[model samples]
Target: MITPLKAVLVGCGSMSRAWTAAAKDIPYLELTGFVDVVEDAARQRAAEYGSPTAVVSADLENTLDRTRPDIVFDCTVPEAHMPVTLTALHYGCHVLGEKPMADSLENARRMVAAASEAGRLYAVIQNRRYDPNIRRLKAFLDSGEIGPITTVHSDFFIGAHFGGFRDRMEHVLLLDMAIHTFDAARLLTGADPVSVYCKEWNPPGSWYEHGASAVAVFEMTGGIVYTYRGSWCAEGLPTTWESEWRFIGRQGSARWPGDERMQAQVVTESGGFLSTVRDAIIPPLPPGAKTGGHAGIIREFVQCIQAGTQPETICSDNIKSLAMVFAAVESAETGLPVSVSV
Candidate 1:
């Protein structure tokens, strides 16, 4: 018989809602506790999720010791990821947490080393990786129908008026949001960043206290160049959260509007200034592709735990994505190209 893994969710904030809700759909997971700095917030989440028996507390270590959970869902802020992950791993629990692995690359590296020392699974909730469109697009790119990729471009424009901590944060766009687009770019290009040159600024009429828009150029491995232009305070005609993407390859090119209708074409005839091209069919998601976003990552993490395996968003790889984010920030600040690492 399969034994349900007991889980303690830390940081019962708005983000925790997704984690708790996902836990409910996985029969192999049981909510054992809720922990937040604000004790009432923990209790509120337990009640909100209908996990009446869940222990609620403000102290993470105390709850972990009491609940003796097998897994910890860290929905905490970026600053708390290390503590939450390290504490959970110390308790011999696997951890799955939100994106941008840590506030800094050093901390991310430390967390990775700690997870390795503890011999526990530590994965990030890079939910966009599980999105159906990205899966299908990545599959098509991998199929070699697009040939070897040479260049990539992505644009994210959203007029987010989020009146919260985000408005006051420094390098708001790069730190708070660009991780998704940068990570997605990595997934599509199948490469790690070699170096990045970026420029950031708070445009006129922007609500963010720091950088609200940025343009970054990345030299990716395999000689693929990836560029990103994004503006959180951009009003009207906003791109999807996934961002508009275009991939150019030796034989063809593919475009995803970051929404409905993705298109790809490969050259069929090698004549004339403009070679004749035919539509490259993007294959459907392979059987059993996880497409449930938050629930999908959570379910996969559970299955990996059950099967004694690791997930795609394991800390090691996710850290590379986080590295790109930090590199971009450094490049923007120094007005020069910066190499990415860790």
Candidate 2:
């Protein structure tokens, strides 16, 4: 019988539940401990998901020393991601962390360096990449059905009223939410950003303390342009969490209306003065374990650890996604386009 890898979960916040659920389904991973700054939170999570003897601690170092887990699931806040990840790496533990990599690009780069020095796997979970519709969209784009994509557009709107740190954060929309959409755009286009011009402002009657709505234009590799417009304080008719997408290509256009359904329009004839257009039926999505979102990322993390391979969201690659977030924020603040540094 194969021995399961011992794992510890840090941060017993709302997101931890998803990680706990995914951990339960992976046969090779065993949850052995829970740690949080608040001991009660750790104890509560342990009671809910861990074994009777599972270790719980208010201090991370103490918990790491006691449990000595093979893997650490870091569900901590963005600002805490670096410290938690670096500490786990120093202790010879692989890490599967929540998104945004770290609070800032410099910190993210440092975490990547630490992971490299430690020679342990450190992967960030950009769960949106696992959505079936997104996978289909990418496959369709790559299959040349739409030809070479020239531009892409995405719109996200939501009226979130979370009464917490997010409402007061300075770059609330970009930092807390837009990262997912930005990361998804990269996955869909198979391109990294080169530069960005952005504008951000708070609409009248907005609940957020700082900028809560913005529009950004990004120049990506292969001369592709991606534009994003989003608002966290939208009051009515909110867009789906996945956002609506439109991909413009040389021969056709593909659109995702923020759900599983996708549509395309391709030019059938162009030799004459008038071009004929026909609806392009999207191919069926590729099959897998039918596991997706957070579960899919968790499975990949575990599999990569076992196989001694780098996950798709390894810090080195994920940092580029994070850079887009930071660059857009900078452009918004400075009122000028900024070059993206990967």
Q: Best lDDT goes to which candidate?
A: 1
Q: List the residue pairs that clash in candidate 1.
A: none
Structural similarity to truth (TM-score) of each candidate: 0.98, 0.97
Cα RMSD to native, each candidate?
A: 1.1, 1.4
Query: Candidate 1 at 280: error in angstroms?
Result: 2.2
Model 1, span 1-342: residue lDDT tens: 666899999988898888888888899789989999999999998997897789999999899889999999999899999888988999999999998788999999999999999999999988888899898888889888979999999999999999999999999999988998998998888898999999999999998899999999999999899999999999999999999999999999999998657999999998799999999877777777768898999999999999889998999888989999999999999999999988
lDDT score at residue 140, model 2, on the 0-100 scale: 81
Q: By how many angstroms RMSD does model 2 differ from the true structure?
A: 1.4
**TM-score top scorer:** 1
Summed backbone clashes in each candidate are: 0, 0
For model 2, give the 10-residue run with minimal summed lDDT.
Answer: 282-291
